[model samples]
Target: MSDGKTIILNRIREALRENPAPRPHASHTSSDQEETPRDHTPREWLPKVGERLDEQIDLFARQSEGLKTEFHRCGTMEDARAILSVLVAEGAWKKIATHTTPDTSALLEKNRAEILKTDTGYQIDDLESCDAGITGCECLVAQTGAILVSAPSAGGRALSVLPPHHIIIARTSQMVPDLTAALELAKERYGNKFPSFLSFITGPSRTGDIERILVLGAHGPKRLTVLLLED
Candidate 1:
Protein backbone atom coordinates (compact mmCIF):
# COMPACT_ATOMS: atom_id res chain seq x y z
CA MET A 1 0.00 0.00 0.00
CA SER A 2 1.09 3.57 -0.55
CA ASP A 3 2.20 5.77 2.33
CA GLY A 4 -1.03 7.76 2.14
CA LYS A 5 -3.08 4.59 2.31
CA THR A 6 -1.06 3.32 5.26
CA ILE A 7 -1.54 6.60 7.11
CA ILE A 8 -5.24 6.54 6.46
CA LEU A 9 -5.51 2.97 7.76
CA ASN A 10 -3.56 3.93 10.86
CA ARG A 11 -5.79 6.92 11.44
CA ILE A 12 -8.86 4.73 11.10
CA ARG A 13 -7.39 2.32 13.64
CA GLU A 14 -6.61 5.17 16.00
CA ALA A 15 -10.08 6.55 15.68
CA LEU A 16 -11.53 3.18 16.55
CA ARG A 17 -9.28 2.90 19.57
CA GLU A 18 -9.98 6.43 20.69
CA ASN A 19 -13.71 5.87 20.47
CA PRO A 20 -14.19 2.80 22.56
CA ALA A 21 -17.53 1.04 22.70
CA PRO A 22 -20.14 3.13 24.43
CA ARG A 23 -20.86 2.03 27.95
CA PRO A 24 -24.46 1.16 28.56
CA HIS A 25 -26.46 3.98 30.02
CA ALA A 26 -27.03 3.98 33.78
CA SER A 27 -30.67 4.91 33.85
CA HIS A 28 -33.00 4.36 30.89
CA THR A 29 -30.04 5.25 28.68
CA SER A 30 -28.01 8.34 29.64
CA SER A 31 -29.78 10.22 32.44
CA ASP A 32 -33.03 9.22 34.05
CA GLN A 33 -34.59 12.26 32.44
CA GLU A 34 -34.22 11.75 28.74
CA GLU A 35 -34.71 14.81 26.60
CA THR A 36 -38.21 14.42 25.41
CA PRO A 37 -39.19 15.39 21.88
CA ARG A 38 -40.40 18.94 21.66
CA ASP A 39 -43.84 19.89 20.42
CA HIS A 40 -43.18 23.30 18.94
CA THR A 41 -43.35 25.32 15.77
CA PRO A 42 -40.76 24.97 12.99
CA ARG A 43 -39.27 28.26 14.10
CA GLU A 44 -38.54 26.77 17.51
CA TRP A 45 -35.23 25.35 16.38
CA LEU A 46 -32.79 26.15 13.61
CA PRO A 47 -34.54 27.62 10.61
CA LYS A 48 -31.49 26.90 8.52
CA VAL A 49 -32.34 23.21 8.62
CA GLY A 50 -35.39 23.77 6.47
CA GLU A 51 -33.47 25.89 4.05
CA ARG A 52 -30.58 23.48 4.14
CA LEU A 53 -32.76 20.51 3.25
CA ASP A 54 -34.44 22.45 0.47
CA GLU A 55 -31.13 23.76 -0.78
CA GLN A 56 -29.53 20.40 -0.32
CA ILE A 57 -32.19 18.82 -2.52
CA ASP A 58 -31.71 21.50 -5.10
CA LEU A 59 -27.97 21.00 -4.94
CA PHE A 60 -28.38 17.25 -5.30
CA ALA A 61 -30.74 17.71 -8.20
CA ARG A 62 -28.04 19.67 -9.94
CA GLN A 63 -25.52 16.93 -9.25
CA SER A 64 -27.85 14.24 -10.46
CA GLU A 65 -29.34 16.26 -13.25
CA GLY A 66 -29.83 13.21 -15.39
CA LEU A 67 -30.77 10.83 -12.61
CA LYS A 68 -34.04 10.52 -10.74
CA THR A 69 -34.87 10.70 -7.04
CA GLU A 70 -37.78 8.86 -5.49
CA PHE A 71 -39.14 8.65 -1.96
CA HIS A 72 -41.61 6.02 -0.79
CA ARG A 73 -43.26 4.70 2.34
CA CYS A 74 -42.58 0.99 2.76
CA GLY A 75 -45.47 -0.47 4.71
CA THR A 76 -44.79 -4.06 3.73
CA MET A 77 -42.28 -6.28 1.97
CA GLU A 78 -44.41 -5.84 -1.13
CA ASP A 79 -44.00 -2.12 -0.83
CA ALA A 80 -40.24 -2.58 -0.77
CA ARG A 81 -40.46 -4.67 -3.94
CA ALA A 82 -42.42 -1.95 -5.68
CA ILE A 83 -39.82 0.64 -4.79
CA LEU A 84 -37.08 -1.63 -6.06
CA SER A 85 -38.95 -1.99 -9.34
CA VAL A 86 -39.10 1.75 -9.82
CA LEU A 87 -35.42 2.09 -9.00
CA VAL A 88 -34.56 -0.64 -11.46
CA ALA A 89 -36.86 0.68 -14.18
CA GLU A 90 -35.24 4.07 -13.95
CA GLY A 91 -31.86 2.35 -14.14
CA ALA A 92 -31.20 4.41 -11.06
CA TRP A 93 -28.43 2.02 -10.10
CA LYS A 94 -26.30 -0.67 -11.64
CA LYS A 95 -26.36 -2.68 -8.42
CA ILE A 96 -28.99 -3.24 -5.76
CA ALA A 97 -28.78 -2.68 -2.00
CA THR A 98 -25.78 -3.90 0.04
CA HIS A 99 -25.49 -5.55 3.46
CA THR A 100 -29.13 -6.50 3.45
CA THR A 101 -31.01 -9.15 5.44
CA PRO A 102 -32.82 -12.23 4.12
CA ASP A 103 -36.13 -10.44 4.06
CA THR A 104 -34.67 -7.54 2.15
CA SER A 105 -32.76 -10.04 0.05
CA ALA A 106 -36.02 -11.76 -0.80
CA LEU A 107 -37.51 -8.46 -1.72
CA LEU A 108 -34.62 -7.73 -4.05
CA GLU A 109 -34.81 -11.09 -5.74
CA LYS A 110 -38.57 -10.90 -6.00
CA ASN A 111 -38.15 -7.62 -7.75
CA ARG A 112 -35.47 -9.16 -10.00
CA ALA A 113 -32.93 -6.53 -9.06
CA GLU A 114 -29.19 -7.12 -9.18
CA ILE A 115 -27.53 -6.68 -5.76
CA LEU A 116 -24.15 -6.97 -4.12
CA LYS A 117 -23.98 -9.42 -1.22
CA THR A 118 -20.97 -9.31 1.06
CA ASP A 119 -19.88 -9.83 4.67
CA THR A 120 -19.09 -6.15 5.21
CA GLY A 121 -15.57 -6.21 3.73
CA TYR A 122 -16.45 -4.81 0.33
CA GLN A 123 -14.38 -2.05 -1.20
CA ILE A 124 -15.41 1.36 -2.49
CA ASP A 125 -15.04 0.32 -6.10
CA ASP A 126 -17.64 -2.38 -5.61
CA LEU A 127 -20.00 0.37 -4.54
CA GLU A 128 -18.85 2.87 -7.16
CA SER A 129 -19.64 0.43 -9.94
CA CYS A 130 -23.17 0.25 -8.67
CA ASP A 131 -25.84 2.70 -9.67
CA ALA A 132 -27.05 3.24 -6.08
CA GLY A 133 -26.70 2.01 -2.51
CA ILE A 134 -29.17 1.22 0.25
CA THR A 135 -28.99 0.28 3.92
CA GLY A 136 -30.87 0.60 7.17
CA CYS A 137 -30.26 3.59 9.39
CA GLU A 138 -29.76 3.60 13.16
CA CYS A 139 -31.70 6.78 13.67
CA LEU A 140 -32.80 10.04 12.09
CA VAL A 141 -32.72 13.49 13.65
CA ALA A 142 -35.52 15.77 12.66
CA GLN A 143 -33.92 18.92 13.95
CA THR A 144 -31.13 18.58 11.40
CA GLY A 145 -32.87 16.27 8.93
CA ALA A 146 -29.98 13.83 9.22
CA ILE A 147 -29.55 10.10 9.50
CA LEU A 148 -27.38 8.38 12.11
CA VAL A 149 -25.63 5.33 10.64
CA SER A 150 -23.21 2.98 12.40
CA ALA A 151 -22.15 -0.67 12.18
CA PRO A 152 -20.21 -2.82 9.73
CA SER A 153 -23.45 -4.21 8.45
CA ALA A 154 -23.92 -0.89 6.76
CA GLY A 155 -20.75 -1.81 4.77
CA GLY A 156 -18.23 0.14 6.83
CA ARG A 157 -18.63 3.66 5.39
CA ALA A 158 -17.79 3.66 1.71
CA LEU A 159 -21.08 2.09 0.70
CA SER A 160 -22.82 5.36 1.45
CA VAL A 161 -20.12 7.60 0.04
CA LEU A 162 -18.79 5.90 -3.05
CA PRO A 163 -22.14 5.41 -4.67
CA PRO A 164 -23.43 8.27 -6.81
CA HIS A 165 -26.84 7.85 -5.19
CA HIS A 166 -28.02 6.31 -1.93
CA ILE A 167 -31.33 5.06 -0.56
CA ILE A 168 -31.61 4.49 3.16
CA ILE A 169 -34.58 2.45 4.34
CA ALA A 170 -35.66 3.37 7.81
CA ARG A 171 -38.77 3.61 9.96
CA THR A 172 -40.25 6.88 11.14
CA SER A 173 -39.68 5.73 14.71
CA GLN A 174 -35.98 6.24 14.12
CA MET A 175 -36.52 9.99 13.95
CA VAL A 176 -35.25 11.78 17.02
CA PRO A 177 -35.60 15.41 18.01
CA ASP A 178 -32.03 16.55 17.45
CA LEU A 179 -28.31 15.80 17.28
CA THR A 180 -27.87 15.85 21.06
CA ALA A 181 -30.27 12.97 21.41
CA ALA A 182 -28.49 11.11 18.62
CA LEU A 183 -25.12 11.46 20.34
CA GLU A 184 -26.56 10.39 23.69
CA LEU A 185 -28.11 7.38 22.04
CA ALA A 186 -24.79 6.49 20.45
CA LYS A 187 -23.00 6.76 23.80
CA GLU A 188 -25.45 4.27 25.24
CA ARG A 189 -25.57 1.74 22.36
CA TYR A 190 -21.92 0.73 22.12
CA GLY A 191 -20.28 2.17 25.24
CA ASN A 192 -16.75 0.78 24.77
CA LYS A 193 -17.25 -1.25 21.60
CA PHE A 194 -18.01 1.45 19.10
CA PRO A 195 -17.26 0.57 15.50
CA SER A 196 -14.59 2.18 13.37
CA PHE A 197 -17.04 4.45 11.58
CA LEU A 198 -20.17 6.38 12.53
CA SER A 199 -21.79 8.81 10.14
CA PHE A 200 -24.32 11.58 10.71
CA ILE A 201 -25.47 12.41 7.20
CA THR A 202 -27.59 15.55 7.11
CA GLY A 203 -27.81 15.67 3.35
CA PRO A 204 -26.13 14.71 0.14
CA SER A 205 -22.42 15.17 -0.48
CA ARG A 206 -21.50 18.80 -1.00
CA THR A 207 -18.72 21.33 -0.70
CA GLY A 208 -17.79 24.91 -1.51
CA ASP A 209 -14.20 24.13 -2.35
CA ILE A 210 -13.89 25.36 -5.91
CA GLU A 211 -13.15 29.08 -5.69
CA ARG A 212 -15.75 29.18 -2.92
CA ILE A 213 -18.32 27.88 -5.38
CA LEU A 214 -20.77 25.39 -3.82
CA VAL A 215 -20.47 22.00 -5.46
CA LEU A 216 -22.48 18.93 -4.83
CA GLY A 217 -21.11 15.39 -5.31
CA ALA A 218 -17.64 16.75 -4.78
CA HIS A 219 -16.84 13.67 -2.72
CA GLY A 220 -19.94 11.51 -2.30
CA PRO A 221 -23.35 10.82 -3.71
CA LYS A 222 -25.18 13.76 -5.24
CA ARG A 223 -28.59 12.32 -4.39
CA LEU A 224 -29.93 10.62 -1.25
CA THR A 225 -33.44 9.25 -0.93
CA VAL A 226 -34.80 8.04 2.36
CA LEU A 227 -37.64 5.51 2.32
CA LEU A 228 -39.26 5.90 5.68
CA LEU A 229 -41.41 3.01 6.78
CA GLU A 230 -44.44 3.33 9.00
CA ASP A 231 -43.92 2.64 12.66
Candidate 2:
Protein backbone atom coordinates (compact mmCIF):
# COMPACT_ATOMS: atom_id res chain seq x y z
CA MET A 1 0.00 0.00 0.00
CA SER A 2 1.04 3.63 -0.43
CA ASP A 3 2.63 5.46 2.52
CA GLY A 4 -0.32 7.87 2.88
CA LYS A 5 -2.84 5.00 2.94
CA THR A 6 -0.70 3.08 5.46
CA ILE A 7 -0.49 6.11 7.72
CA ILE A 8 -4.26 6.59 7.59
CA LEU A 9 -4.83 2.92 8.41
CA ASN A 10 -2.43 3.16 11.35
CA ARG A 11 -4.32 6.16 12.76
CA ILE A 12 -7.66 4.36 12.42
CA ARG A 13 -6.28 1.29 14.19
CA GLU A 14 -4.91 3.46 16.97
CA ALA A 15 -8.28 5.15 17.43
CA LEU A 16 -10.00 1.77 17.59
CA ARG A 17 -7.51 0.57 20.18
CA GLU A 18 -8.13 3.64 22.33
CA ASN A 19 -11.87 3.11 22.34
CA PRO A 20 -12.78 -0.45 21.47
CA ALA A 21 -16.23 -1.32 20.20
CA PRO A 22 -18.40 -3.98 21.85
CA ARG A 23 -17.89 -7.46 20.44
CA PRO A 24 -20.87 -8.36 18.27
CA HIS A 25 -20.76 -12.03 19.15
CA ALA A 26 -18.75 -13.96 21.70
CA SER A 27 -17.75 -16.56 19.12
CA HIS A 28 -18.56 -17.57 15.56
CA THR A 29 -20.18 -20.93 15.04
CA SER A 30 -18.72 -23.34 12.57
CA SER A 31 -20.52 -23.15 9.20
CA ASP A 32 -22.55 -26.11 8.03
CA GLN A 33 -21.04 -27.95 5.06
CA GLU A 34 -23.85 -26.84 2.67
CA GLU A 35 -24.12 -23.32 4.00
CA THR A 36 -22.67 -20.39 2.07
CA PRO A 37 -20.35 -17.95 3.83
CA ARG A 38 -21.89 -14.51 4.33
CA ASP A 39 -20.82 -11.25 5.90
CA HIS A 40 -23.04 -9.83 8.70
CA THR A 41 -21.18 -6.57 9.31
CA PRO A 42 -24.05 -4.35 8.22
CA ARG A 43 -26.60 -6.24 10.28
CA GLU A 44 -24.30 -6.20 13.30
CA TRP A 45 -23.55 -2.50 12.99
CA LEU A 46 -27.12 -1.40 12.23
CA PRO A 47 -29.20 -3.57 14.54
CA LYS A 48 -32.92 -2.94 14.65
CA VAL A 49 -33.84 -0.22 17.15
CA GLY A 50 -37.33 -1.77 17.49
CA GLU A 51 -39.17 1.45 18.13
CA ARG A 52 -42.14 3.08 16.42
CA LEU A 53 -42.09 6.81 15.76
CA ASP A 54 -44.03 7.75 18.88
CA GLU A 55 -41.84 5.52 21.05
CA GLN A 56 -38.76 7.08 19.51
CA ILE A 57 -40.11 10.54 20.13
CA ASP A 58 -40.71 9.68 23.76
CA LEU A 59 -37.20 8.38 24.14
CA PHE A 60 -35.87 11.46 22.41
CA ALA A 61 -37.68 13.79 24.77
CA ARG A 62 -36.53 11.85 27.84
CA GLN A 63 -32.90 11.86 26.75
CA SER A 64 -33.01 15.53 25.85
CA GLU A 65 -34.49 16.33 29.25
CA GLY A 66 -31.59 14.45 30.78
CA LEU A 67 -29.35 16.92 28.98
CA LYS A 68 -31.40 19.95 30.15
CA THR A 69 -33.06 20.61 26.80
CA GLU A 70 -36.55 22.05 27.01
CA PHE A 71 -39.29 20.80 24.68
CA HIS A 72 -42.45 22.44 23.39
CA ARG A 73 -44.94 20.52 21.27
CA CYS A 74 -47.15 22.55 18.94
CA GLY A 75 -50.07 21.42 16.86
CA THR A 76 -49.45 24.13 14.27
CA MET A 77 -46.92 26.69 13.13
CA GLU A 78 -48.99 29.42 14.76
CA ASP A 79 -48.69 27.65 18.08
CA ALA A 80 -44.94 27.48 17.58
CA ARG A 81 -44.90 31.16 16.82
CA ALA A 82 -46.82 31.94 19.99
CA ILE A 83 -44.38 29.87 22.02
CA LEU A 84 -41.42 31.72 20.53
CA SER A 85 -43.11 35.05 20.98
CA VAL A 86 -43.74 34.29 24.62
CA LEU A 87 -40.13 33.20 25.06
CA VAL A 88 -38.80 36.42 23.65
CA ALA A 89 -41.26 38.59 25.50
CA GLU A 90 -40.73 36.89 28.84
CA GLY A 91 -36.99 36.27 28.55
CA ALA A 92 -36.25 39.78 27.35
CA TRP A 93 -34.22 38.67 24.35
CA LYS A 94 -33.73 41.93 22.51
CA LYS A 95 -32.25 40.50 19.37
CA ILE A 96 -32.57 37.11 17.64
CA ALA A 97 -30.72 35.35 14.84
CA THR A 98 -32.12 32.69 12.54
CA HIS A 99 -31.37 31.05 9.21
CA THR A 100 -32.95 31.97 5.89
CA THR A 101 -34.69 28.61 5.49
CA PRO A 102 -38.31 29.20 4.50
CA ASP A 103 -39.85 27.75 7.62
CA THR A 104 -37.78 29.71 10.10
CA SER A 105 -37.69 32.77 7.84
CA ALA A 106 -41.46 32.78 7.67
CA LEU A 107 -41.66 32.58 11.44
CA LEU A 108 -39.26 35.49 11.72
CA GLU A 109 -41.29 37.59 9.35
CA LYS A 110 -43.94 38.41 11.94
CA ASN A 111 -41.31 39.91 14.25
CA ARG A 112 -39.00 41.48 11.71
CA ALA A 113 -37.93 44.34 13.92
CA GLU A 114 -36.17 41.96 16.33
CA ILE A 115 -34.61 39.58 13.80
CA LEU A 116 -30.98 39.60 12.73
CA LYS A 117 -31.56 37.83 9.44
CA THR A 118 -28.25 37.71 7.59
CA ASP A 119 -28.08 39.35 4.10
CA THR A 120 -31.55 40.87 4.37
CA GLY A 121 -30.06 43.97 5.98
CA TYR A 122 -28.61 41.80 8.77
CA GLN A 123 -25.02 40.50 8.89
CA ILE A 124 -22.92 37.73 10.48
CA ASP A 125 -21.31 39.87 13.17
CA ASP A 126 -24.74 40.83 14.52
CA LEU A 127 -25.38 37.23 15.57
CA GLU A 128 -22.59 37.28 18.13
CA SER A 129 -24.51 39.84 20.15
CA CYS A 130 -27.97 38.40 19.54
CA ASP A 131 -29.60 36.90 22.62
CA ALA A 132 -30.76 33.76 20.85
CA GLY A 133 -30.73 31.92 17.52
CA ILE A 134 -33.13 29.68 15.67
CA THR A 135 -33.01 27.30 12.68
CA GLY A 136 -34.70 24.33 11.07
CA CYS A 137 -33.31 20.81 11.50
CA GLU A 138 -32.87 17.90 9.07
CA CYS A 139 -34.04 15.14 11.42
CA LEU A 140 -34.60 14.25 15.03
CA VAL A 141 -32.78 11.04 16.05
CA ALA A 142 -34.91 9.64 18.86
CA GLN A 143 -32.47 6.94 19.94
CA THR A 144 -29.90 9.54 20.91
CA GLY A 145 -32.13 12.58 21.44
CA ALA A 146 -30.17 14.34 18.74
CA ILE A 147 -31.24 16.92 16.16
CA LEU A 148 -29.53 16.20 12.85
CA VAL A 149 -28.53 19.51 11.26
CA SER A 150 -26.88 20.12 7.93
CA ALA A 151 -25.93 23.21 6.01
CA PRO A 152 -28.73 22.96 3.46
CA SER A 153 -31.49 22.44 5.99
CA ALA A 154 -30.11 24.72 8.69
CA GLY A 155 -28.92 27.47 6.28
CA GLY A 156 -25.54 28.00 7.94
CA ARG A 157 -23.44 25.99 10.38
CA ALA A 158 -22.42 29.11 12.23
CA LEU A 159 -26.08 30.05 12.79
CA SER A 160 -26.67 26.76 14.54
CA VAL A 161 -23.55 26.70 16.76
CA LEU A 162 -22.64 30.27 17.58
CA PRO A 163 -25.59 31.58 19.54
CA PRO A 164 -26.03 31.47 23.33
CA HIS A 165 -29.60 30.16 23.16
CA HIS A 166 -30.35 27.82 20.24
CA ILE A 167 -33.82 26.88 19.16
CA ILE A 168 -34.75 24.12 16.74
CA ILE A 169 -37.92 24.30 14.69
CA ALA A 170 -38.69 20.85 13.32
CA ARG A 171 -41.65 18.84 12.07
CA THR A 172 -42.90 15.48 13.37
CA SER A 173 -42.17 13.88 10.01
CA GLN A 174 -38.44 14.26 10.62
CA MET A 175 -38.50 11.79 13.49
CA VAL A 176 -36.36 8.65 13.18
CA PRO A 177 -35.59 5.79 15.53
CA ASP A 178 -31.84 5.99 15.61
CA LEU A 179 -28.66 7.38 14.16
CA THR A 180 -28.53 4.66 11.49
CA ALA A 181 -32.06 5.45 10.33
CA ALA A 182 -31.33 9.17 10.31
CA LEU A 183 -28.16 8.60 8.29
CA GLU A 184 -30.07 6.46 5.81
CA LEU A 185 -32.64 9.22 5.33
CA ALA A 186 -29.88 11.74 4.84
CA LYS A 187 -28.28 9.43 2.26
CA GLU A 188 -31.56 9.28 0.33
CA ARG A 189 -31.92 13.05 0.53
CA TYR A 190 -28.41 14.01 -0.49
CA GLY A 191 -27.26 11.04 -2.58
CA ASN A 192 -23.50 11.08 -3.32
CA LYS A 193 -23.24 14.83 -2.67
CA PHE A 194 -23.74 16.35 0.81
CA PRO A 195 -23.32 19.59 2.68
CA SER A 196 -20.01 20.77 4.12
CA PHE A 197 -21.23 20.31 7.70
CA LEU A 198 -23.84 18.15 9.40
CA SER A 199 -24.14 18.28 13.17
CA PHE A 200 -25.83 15.99 15.70
CA ILE A 201 -26.88 18.16 18.60
CA THR A 202 -28.12 16.47 21.75
CA GLY A 203 -28.48 19.46 24.03
CA PRO A 204 -26.89 22.56 25.44
CA SER A 205 -23.11 22.81 25.42
CA ARG A 206 -21.58 21.52 28.62
CA THR A 207 -18.33 20.33 30.11
CA GLY A 208 -16.90 18.97 33.35
CA ASP A 209 -13.39 20.10 32.56
CA ILE A 210 -12.89 22.46 35.45
CA GLU A 211 -12.23 20.05 38.32
CA ARG A 212 -15.13 17.92 37.13
CA ILE A 213 -17.69 20.50 38.15
CA LEU A 214 -20.61 20.77 35.73
CA VAL A 215 -20.64 23.81 33.51
CA LEU A 216 -23.31 24.83 31.03
CA GLY A 217 -22.55 26.60 27.77
CA ALA A 218 -18.86 25.91 28.17
CA HIS A 219 -18.18 26.12 24.45
CA GLY A 220 -21.54 26.94 22.87
CA PRO A 221 -25.21 27.59 23.57
CA LYS A 222 -26.17 27.81 27.21
CA ARG A 223 -29.71 26.71 26.49
CA LEU A 224 -31.42 24.59 23.82
CA THR A 225 -35.11 24.50 23.13
CA VAL A 226 -36.93 22.36 20.60
CA LEU A 227 -40.28 23.24 19.09
CA LEU A 228 -41.73 20.06 17.68
CA LEU A 229 -44.48 20.64 15.12
CA GLU A 230 -47.04 17.99 15.69
CA ASP A 231 -49.38 16.68 13.02
Q: What C-alpha lDDT values do all the predictions have?
A: 0.66, 0.80
Q: Tens digits of per-residue lDDT for model 2 on 1-231?
A: 579989999999989887778645535565654433345434355534545777777888888889899887788888888888888887788889876776787567576347776534455578788888898888998877889999877767777778798999988899988887788998999998998899999899999998999899987999999999875
TM-scores vs. true structure, each candidate: 0.64, 0.78
Q: What does candidate 1's lDDT look like per residue over 34-130, in tens digits? A: 4443433335544333334345433333323333334455787678778767767887455764777554465566655567755546655665688
Global fold similarity of model 2 (TM-score): 0.78
By summed lDDT, which 10 consecutive residues of candidate 1 come out lowest?
A: 60-69
RMSD of 2: 5.8
Off by over 4 Å in 1: 1-71, 211-213
Runs of candidate 2 exceeding 4 Å displacement: 1-50, 119-124
Q: lDDT (0-100) at residue 11 of candidate 1? A: 90
Worst ten-residue run, lDDT, model 2? 34-43
Score candidate 1 by lDDT. 0.66
Best by lDDT: 2
